[model samples]
Target: MSRNQQIWLGELIRCWKALAPADDNTRKTLAGLVGFAWQPPVDQREPEATPAPEPELPPPVAPSAAPPQPMTQKPKEPPPNPQASELPRVAIEEEAQLQAAEWDSVEVLNPPQPHNRQYNNLLPPLFRPLWSRTIVTTLASRRLPIGFVDAERLVSTMAAARPVERIPRQPRWTTMKGVQLLLDKTPGMAPFLSDQAALAALFDDCVGGEALERLHFFDSPLRGVVIGGKKAAYRPPQPGVPVVAVTDLGLGAPESHFNRAAPGEWLSLVQLLAARDSTLTILLPWPAAAADPGLQRCTAIVEWDRSTSATLVRRLLERICG
Candidate 1:
């Protein structure tokens, strides 16, 4: 213990002894604690037996008129048993403190240890349950279907000689390509660990584990990273695949946190995806406007927070379909 702590303890033992206050539970507890620790009058252990008395030589007797009084001897007392005990006392033994306490002593207490803690979820649910397919459609690739006929085109294919063996449906946009999930794994995204897990489970249900591919990147996707113990140069999935990235775009970082993604870093990513004819959906904790306006124009940005709704995801699909 430090000198200051020992000094305070000495003062506490002294003042508490004088007060002998026990009006409340706090005071009573402190008294008990101090008594238990200092224990000025702790019980002393008792020995099993006293050593045997040595043999005494006969004493020289003086001749007297009356017969010498028979030698008188005192009886020996047995040693006290160690098993006999006394309960520890918190009250000071001084008569003055006892009299003062009877007149009513005041109580005091040090702060007790915290018994409870404030709890909070770093990430709340964004998408409602059973709406997995909605997210799938929002983040999946759409392509014009072949082997199907437009109603207008079929009406124009006039020879009338074509057998109606196969009824051709109208050509339309179909959500066909698998999804690529790029989740940020930097220290800044630590709070969203649970959020990532929920998102992963939802995507797994939509495309199944085999169809969904999840890649973890430290700060930016345009940098080299390791996956499954193999280091690889960063690359996006095949062309026409949708990439849904859950990132903060370094907007959530403090000024001192330099190891974060910048607008340029993400813009380079946007250019790469554009070249591949793939859409990019950024699930950010903040709004799309927080990022550079130019970057927002190229990437479909959706806030990855509780405020996100089914309508918002539909809008994302509309943006991608365009």
Candidate 2:
């Protein structure tokens, strides 16, 4: 198509002719036609350079003084080719570095805090109040850290002789004397029953050595029942133990109470107290008659009769200990 392409093609034809098994004359003719000139047999042929044509001159310069014309020259060429594919290598590296820096500079937003939750709406409003009323307000009312057991002495004695501290007697429900003894012996019974030592310390100031000496369990000889806060006990009293206090402590009582309510109001106040308070002993009204279900609502029932002040104290104690 172009002059260079035609020349290259002619050179290729000359080469092909030399390699062919044609006659020497034919090969010589082909070389001449392709513009390949041969030298004498004794000497090798040398390539000759063709002189370029002179550039055209400008018109005659004026006589007046003027600046000289600048020389016209070809532009400087780049260095020899490396490879086209390698051109983007540097750009790729720079782009990756920029992305990493941008990611590092970005800051993360904090998550939102959760909202406070309330009781289910299906439950009656009375359930919450009853539950709150039953929970223990003092450590003296619980079973753990008995008022009778001296922690320091107990720990020391246990370390000296045995590997574990000896369990001390914790007074539970029994006869009227047992109830009086529990009240008289440990005025801080509500606070002392908690497992937390810090909470028990609150009642430690109220309970004395005298109350500690007389502390005893009902029926069972075992000392000090561990009660409340994660680990707790809901032991039903034995046949011999008298009903000093009554409570709807069993699950069956609450289930029955739940059945009595209307279809929409399924929860029982007594059950709500047991679930939430974990301390108050809920007293259910005795059955109205022989065939009545009220009597079955509670395992034990005790009649409380005292002066206004005494009644208040008894109620307070019941709230704390139950």
Best by lDDT: 1
Quickly count the clashes in candidate 2: 24
lDDT of 2 by residue, 178-282 (tens): 110111112222222222222122122233222221222321112232233232233423222211222112222333343222311112422333454333222
Q: Estimate each model's TM-score.
A: 0.53, 0.17
- lDDT by residue (tens digit), candidate 1, 191-306: 88777777776677656667788888878888855678675678888887888888888777667888887788888988898789787888887777887887788777887655
Model 2: residues with Cα > 4 Å off, grouped in runs: 1-144, 150-162, 165-272, 275-300, 303-322
**Colliding pairs, model 1:** none
lDDT of 1: 0.64
Worst lDDT run of 10 residues, candidate 1, spans 36-45
Model 2: what TM-score? 0.17
Q: Which residue runs of candidate 1 sit more than 4 Å off their true CA positions?
A: 1-123, 130-133, 141-143, 146-148, 153-175
Q: How much is the lDDT of residue 252 in candidate 2?
A: 22
